[model samples]
Target: MNSIIYGPVPSWRLGRSLGVDLLCAPGKTCSFDCVYCQLGRTTSATTERREFVSMARLTEELKEVRGINADYVTFSGTGEPTIASNLGQAIDLARSILHLPIAVLTNSSLISREDVRGDLAKADVVVAKLDAHSQELLRQVNRPMAGLMLSDIIAGIKLFKSKFTGKLCLQIMFIEANKNFAVEIAQVASCLLPDELQLNTPLRPCPVKPLPPPQMASIKGNFHNFRNVVTVYEAPRPEVKPLNLQETLRRRPKL
Candidate 1:
């Protein structure tokens, strides 16, 4: 059987995160073509939400994860999770079978849509992206889909904040393109008022050279307007390393 899931990858913020690929394959589809995307650019940037994978199959795969130790069961792959038409169904299935908290790492592109918001409302944690404050920088860094606009994205986040009872973390990826607008970005983040604000820089090589880590003191001083703040950088993870072929097979014996 083809594995639609990958990685109990060590994350700097979330401990061991088990990832679910809602896209067709590992690197096949996505909504945005971000400049600093660790997985590189999107091969296809479609906004339409559809059932890319069968709910029954995803449910069976999730049952297997119950035996694995994971801090979070994440809805993230090479693409956007909210674009999966069956996302709400998948979340329900995973919740029923697994004890781990459900987390969705999204670009916040479609959260403005009521249906998307309704789908994500079921998750335990929603980490939405807000790397750019202005429309110009948003286009430069995120390179969002043809019709998506910055206002729409921000509006969606605000809407999600109004309704979602779960934890909301605003993930800001600080690249050179948006570094100068950090204060403006903070102001925007203050408006959304998420539960936590996670500031991060690129950990891997990007289409362009990523920005040096923002001065922690300086960023904190500027973005202190947000109620709760947490900053993450491209720091070394001493406890974690990429799993080799043998170790990977060992972890998933059935594979």
Candidate 2:
């Protein structure tokens, strides 16, 4: 079978994460043309969702993952996870067969929609992106789909905060363009009162050059009031044997 699932990739925050691609055919689809995207831009930007792959097929692949030891079962690959309308059903099915906690990485643009928020609520952890506090900066950094308003996105995040009881981690992808507005971004993050604020900069080659790592002393002095803040830079990879399907499954906990 052509693999619908890929990578027990090393994630700085989630440890060894097993990724589930809900959009794209192994590679395709996305909501934003992110400057720092590792997989490049979406050939077709869309909000529509379908069963990108059969649940039966995904379940079969997941059975292999069931033997791998991963810290998280992440809903992230080539694009935004929320764009998949069948996401809630997929999450339900995955939960039924997998014992690990689920994490969804979203751009936070669609979470304002009631249906999207309802679906995301099922995730154990929702890491939402908020790179810019102002509309202009939002446009520069994310280069989101046309008609996506920054104000509306913020409002959606606030709405999700009100209804979802799961852990919400605000991921701020700092770049040179938005570094000057760090204080303002921190203020905006304060309002959301996220469970955690993760400060990160582009580690991958970006369309635009990224800023130098934020001055830790300065950033700390400025944004310490907001909930727990954690800053990370890319860590050097350790050489290890590449894991095969059986080895990966052996490490994973039974559902």
lDDT of each: 0.77, 0.74
Q: State the lDDT at 196 in candidate 2.
A: 83
Clashing pairs in 1: none
Model 1: residues >4 Å from true position, as ranges? 214-217, 234-255
Count of clashing pairs, candidate 1? 0
Best by TM-score: 1
Per-residue error for 230 in candidate 1, Å, reads 1.6
Summarize candidate 1's per-residue lDDT along 110-136 as a digit string, tens digits.
988999999999999999999888888
Cα error of candidate 1 at position 39, Å: 1.2
TM-score of each prediction: 0.89, 0.88
lDDT of 1 at 35: 84
Compute the lDDT for candidate 2. 0.74
Report the C-alpha lDDT of model 2 over 1-255, residue by residue, as the tens digit: 346565676666777777787764644477777777766666768766556777787788888767676777888766778888878877887777778888888988888788899889999999999999888888888888888888998999998998888899999877667777889998898888899887777665546665565554455556789757777654333332334555434222111
